[model samples]
Target chain A: MKRVRMRRLKVEKRTNPSAWTVFCISLVSILLAFVVIGFIFLGFGINPLEAYLEIIIETVGNSYGLSQIVWQSIPLLLCGVGLLLAFKTSFWNIGAEGQLLMGATAATWVALFSPLPEPFLIPAAFILGFAGGAVWGLLSTSLRSRFGINEVITTLMMNYIASNIVLYLIHGPWKGETMRGFAYTDQFPESVWLPTIGMSDIHWPTLLLGLFAAVCVFFILNRTRLGYEVKVVGQSPKAARYAGISYFKTIFYVMVISGGLAGLAGAGEVLGVHHMLRHSDQVSLGYGYTAIIVAWLARGNPLIVILTSLLFGAIYVAGDVLQLSFNLPFQIVNVFTGLILFFLISSDTLLKHKLSFRKGE
Target chain B: MKKAVLFALCLVFLLTGAIGLQAQDKLKVGFIYVGPIGDMGWTHAHEVARRIVEDTFPWVETVYQESVPEAKVEGVIDRMVRRERCAVVFTTSFGFWEGTVAAAKKYPDTIFAHCSGFMRAPNLATYMADFYQIYYLNGLMAGALTKSNKVGYVGAFPIPEVKRHINAFTMGVREVNPKAEVHVRWIEAWFDPAKAKEATNSLIDAGCDVFAFTEDSDTVVQVAAENRMPVFGHYSPMYNSAPDYVVSGQLVHWENFYLDFLSKVHAGYYTSKNLENVDYWDLLKEGSVEVGAKFGMPVNPKWKSRLGKTYDLVMERIAQMSDFQMVFDPFTGPIYSRKGAVVVPVGVRANYGHLLSLEYAVKGVVGSWPGEPK
Candidate 1:
């Protein structure tokens, strides 16, 4: 007797994959991560539901809380946009953090030395910040373009260099004459400070500027010929070359744009949130690294990057609430983050490959 | 198909079994730090104290993770409390304030102790030490030893804790030599070795022959020593970290403080109200705060004699103050903000509340405060 064979599940070739499916998968991943974390919490003797709720409320529940969450997301959005820009053209610019440090260092220099009036000060600070970051980015891109250096390594190394340079500046020449035995610079001048809009707890300038940055990136990535070229390069370097796009120039241009955005983020942070770029690790919130995830999750879509950033911001806010509310170990968020990112990445595997089972393989 | 079903079943069973087992543990204590435990500064100090609690009290269990960022702090705390069943938590950084406060409120039964902060709730309390007392003595060494009379300080942040230490050190410097002027470089981070070293070099180049720092790593001291400059160390016996550049340094003995708190908590005396008065001020005599290891000649002769004398005096005073009262207050009067605001008039001591609330730079301090606390 002839037996009919059942059709294999072609997970990769679905009738059509919808946004809803992606959303469901992400939600499931988050839930699964939470459940596993909940067990870990149970081992610590904590109530999982209470912990989850605490995170949600802290991150997005109330006005003050939401304001803080969004306030923190500003830097992430800026970095994420820049990273997304590089990701679009297959140019991995992991040096946004370093670039940010360079921007901060330059802005700090102007803040300390430039006697520009308030009007000129803000613009000059931003220009200097952008230029500084762009320069740092260009160096890495040029090395990659010219010497074929891997940008990931170069950018990572540059972060240390940039941060150390700031460290040296604050400690040596810019060291305040009276700070006890610390290694930080004094506060930025009031004239150069970012103004809070409408008497709100939120710094409107940073939020708006971040949104503006997102819009600008969206335009560059979607509306312009450069954006189209970037997509082609990202898809296939050889194909892009056949299409007459110069990989070296594209790499250099994207790196500069990415680094400049990061620089603006650093400047915004110094001018908007912290006002003074002290030696504190609070300068840029490691936004550059996290933005990689944001860009990837958004698939290099600038608008999606903004939303992803907000989601991360919410998670950050909620994590704090849960920590205080539940006496949760601060690392719990890291575990959650690890889980989320893990699942987010794995979701692609699920989408592309069908799971099969055998009795003994 | 059958294997897939089995895999799903196994996953469910494992998750459920794990949950069932975790439902039956005793209370957990979660501790968080801003830096790694390897760094012998803020994180190390807390870690040592945590070990004391774990070792001395067998019934109590505690766990900790280090090198957390401000943005991620809240989530870490959540996992510790909700999933781990932590009845108490300790956040070791000042940035943990708003997050910790919210956590304490959400988990009313859980207790929280925030280091170097004043925020509180019925279940949360504030805990910190008088590390500034040692800073004053450190300043004395910097003041007495500086060939250029320009001493440099490397700090973490301009927060009250750091600001107070700077003021105390400056006062110590001034007490010995009125002509001495302290220069401060803020590294803005608790631990970044290269940065700390770079700052040290910067100060050394600025004609500051004496160096000191409030950072966790001893790179600053090492940097000063490399340049043949004298340095006063902060947070514990950093002289061991830099044996060459040491005149003296401030030390934080966390065992006693942790022992006292854990003992009281174990004894059922750990309510937040009682914990308020449980603020411990460990002194040199009590072996809580040390004035550094008595050593050979300081890099500079003036520093050697002056540090010895100041260390002895501080030790003597600390020994006599059994009640932890009427001692050194860093924000004493005649203090001026860098913006020229008189923070405290001369001959007048600052109130604890005000000093703890310090937000501005003192007069003669260079540089600007960043971000939003203007």
Candidate 2:
């Protein structure tokens, strides 16, 4: 009898993958995710290809859809940029959502309660927004620094606190007088309304600010001494200690910038999107949590986050389109987003490893 | 890859042309819902109404986007108007006020109807199928059957709508048994099962045997029934959830308004420019709401005898409220607040303005009341 010959499979580390290869791999990864999602669409009796085509036409093919997608990205970009920085320092700041809510809260104060004149309202709102977000971020940092509490749990828990805070405000003191028994704050006066691009909801001010943040963070992560320290601390806390890099200061900066940026996103929601402080769910739509996927997909590159955020914006719009056209359930969107995240995460493994086939011994 | 991309583009073009051809001359109507249509309460009723109009009117084409976030309502409206070419849009949710108004201004030629909201534009109108009257009728039954004489009320929010219902229910309870108290608990949400369960359990623990609620789900009814307590269901029918436990509920018939409104739209009566004052604040008289354990079952037969002497009163109240002349209202004159403030003076029927902004607890209510008079 002929001995059964088996072909051996081996896994080896790919030291470095070029940009082109990684791009191709990522593209394939996205397509694979869509292919999987398409099957789910089939389960719902929808033609996957037609649904995909409809989404493309609605979002990129139509001007209004394009603007809405672009508008959706502003919050994600702001939150994602902040998250990538915190992740780089390995601080795992998971409370960008809370920070964003706090920022919106601060913006609401300036817009509604402050005595600031019209000319100063927007600027004052943004400043207070940033400060509000940073303060919320620092609370968790102090706990981690002083008491050695795990930041992941603290950050996640604080998100609930932030949302509840928004809930309490909108339900209580901030409930609009003319809203006639609804749970939301009064609309901001026109003086503080962020200027948009034409008839679209795209607030150029927030979009430009988010881009500027991305660029500045890119530069900081690539060129600065603090960038090097952040990498080392993230890569090895022991090495950071040996090299005399201050973990406290590095984490402090990451938390501040991350939280502050998320706050700015929150303020943008009020100033640019809703023009009022609303329920936290309405204000964010899970942008803070979704931005984690955005940052993760960017693979530590701040500039890459622009594309990732836009991709997420399109995904969200596609979800809306599905609901509009197909009458699918809300969980369909979660499943779609989850499948993409799962596939993208798996693709990250392929970027680091190569598979080989060996002949039988 | 390039060829595949080209093929995809062609498919998109063909699909676009196909959709354009199918659009034809139908009056496209769009609905924006803040919750899923299957929620079995507000949005479900709206969805049912949408289907009715779609089926009944040959010239109407309906589409909807459910679970829309209030912040994203504007975007959904844009897509509805621009992409779907919706001539008439109905946004159902109080939180959608600003978005509906903005969309009304953005699309002047488009007709917009908003539900349960105050702010309206020339192109946007507001409508609501209030059940305070039905709630009062249910309260009458609750007042009669409560063994503990402590009626538990699981309120969704302290908003005026819920407050009005609770007040009306309390009025009915007090009218029947003046010594009985209405214990209230607020869950601070329109629909939250866990919180609803917790609130119901807490109420049960406090020895309130009879129950009524303003939540979007049957959680309160189910919870109360679990403890062998009789309950009045909130929005939608709950006899199926716990048939023996649920006595009666306030049900909304949104299709009455939808059919009337859409027919008017189709007949060119409701144009884009004339909706500013066209509010459809329909109630029992208009048949927009009902008092029942389920549709066509005003009272559970099991509880009919249990109500005994109070069944006649419930029937009478329903008949009076359902009359076009409207002989009686739950919020009649000489009603006093729990703190002795005059809610309604003698012989003064609570008008639309007063009922829409009511924020007081009646004499028999026991709980924290936000926005109550000081």
Candidate 3:
């Protein structure tokens, strides 16, 4: 009777993680990270206190800045949702960046090369982008299932290959002769662009679309047959197989959904902020990689990806603010981001037990 | 453990602080380089200029970051101004124009100089190398040299900088041989050797014996030399890359202009008024530009004299020149956009406003502008 009571208590405790508690812990961790960032200022011959204040104010102080933050968060949310899907099924899709590139590639090809008219073109671009990403994802899935290769390495490698393919095309066969030596295809026609909501600085369509995706993922994960199988498979593949779940089928489904979401993100980015694909300024920002951290921080919950992506988006914007206003090396921003991701991922320890203090022998 | 980590980090901070403090009295100038200093192209030219500043001015101090992205450049400029307290900050990318403007607006007391941009503020000044005119001369040389009259060009991004270079070269090509058709390939990245080689290969395959490119790597010249084709290079003399094949180059001499600017700023004689009008020309006689230093002997000996006369005539014409202006009106009539639109009239030059905020390609170049779809 006592043993049964203890087991029940353990289960209850395991299921009862308060969101506020996690939020506070993360806040403290971020504050600690800032203290480390302060030391970076001493090297640059600036007051750390003043630099910190400037970063905070510039990133979040006013409406315009806030708008910029929201704009940056859209890609993160889209990518984070994709990350969440793959991670839930134990497939580490590290190629969200590549998937995003391929999506842009397909969308641009449709926008420029295809003769599809008006409303049909915009949807077609998104669909083609999704299909492009799915194809990329399928490559990894097949490699993992058939050859027993690691999906992570294959996916990451594919990103480079896909990017290079697009690079070659834009500069070669697709390039206009009159614009000789310029590395780009023709500009995307205006008729095929995604429509933005009424003069709002933030893209409401993307935000709403992301929210809708989250709801769909939430229902699929918690209320569908596939969701239960994914959970079981992620926890223990041997048990999942015993329970009649085909590993190959599960991997294929997870990758398709994952890549599709990432593709949607690429479409959103080109449609939302950049408008066209400029290969020069695209990759260095690491929006795709940051989404991995966002998904991890949110504990792979589709609903929580929004908050986590925004938090990361805030860091990205604040890092830029800190670098510009403080004259700090942009590398320092990478360091802080790396530290925050490290702490956030490691904080999973809290799910098991509380840290306790003991006397030395 | 915490104390040790903190102490080590603090030591690093102090060391950096000492360096920063030492920079102030020395006429501190911060340069935001867009590529690695080792890149033989764009950033290399700037670094050479920075070195010239250091060599010429004993009191001037320069700090820089190589391989910085456009999105993060604002932070570096901010730090240079507010933290390092640099008297002058030079942002060296067209994309950095907005960031520099924001910085100049926010800190009106500091001087901000941008390369290849048009944004102007009381404290902000714009400057560019004007390589297009020189490239036009090279195009003339290639036009005279090529037996087939098929010229190839390899460029980076399709920004106005690259576009103007190609367009000017094309005009020069047509000036010499109206039948000469220029073939161009753009490798998106600035300094990848493999892509550069591939682009060279593609152009070569397309029957272009004369090659020119705006790439930052030496691979273009190397590939040209290997394939035994005459190639015009961009940024710095490419004699070292390929003495046999390189005929002309558009070199950037940043030192002379950089030294002049720094000396004035250092002496406190620099004003927004003076800086705004400080558009110094990079010409052959000014030690900032040199052309045809590596133009090799042609396979046909009889054709050499004619090429020499053409070169001499071009030199004479450029000698009478003050600035390399865009003569071709891409937006005018008689010009066909790649999309078949009769955009510009034949006679009028594209005005500064349209050229600066160019959103579309003048009918020949394929691809979207800065913010178009795929």
Specify the highest-DockQ model's number. 2
Off by over 4 Å in 3: A1-94, A101-228, A234-277, A280-361, B1-21, B272-287, B294-308, B322-374
Better of 1 and 2 by lDDT: 2
lDDT of 2 by residue, B163-260 (tens): 99999999999888888899999998878999999998988888899999988888888788878889987778888999998899988889899899
Worst 10 residues of 2 chain A by lDDT: A178-187
Per-candidate TM vs. native? 0.61, 0.97, 0.63
Q: Measured by C-alpha RMSD in angstroms, how accurate is candidate 3?
A: 10.0
For residue A263, give model 3's deviation from the true position in Å. 6.2
lDDT of 3 by residue, B265-289 (tens): 7777886545666555455445555
Candidate 1 error regions (>4 Å)? A1-16, A197-201, A353-361, B1-374
lDDT of 1 by residue, A139-197 (tens): 88878877898988998889888877877676566765444323456667788877765
In candidate 2, stretches whose alpha carbon ends up further than 4 angstroms from where it belongs are A1-8, B1-11
Candidate 1 lDDT tens digits, B42-147: 7887888788878877777776767676545665676677556677788887666656876776677777888766667777877777666667766666666666
TM-score of chain B alone in model 2? 0.97
Assess the local accuracy of residue B309 in candidate 2 as a C-alpha lDDT between 0 and 100.
87
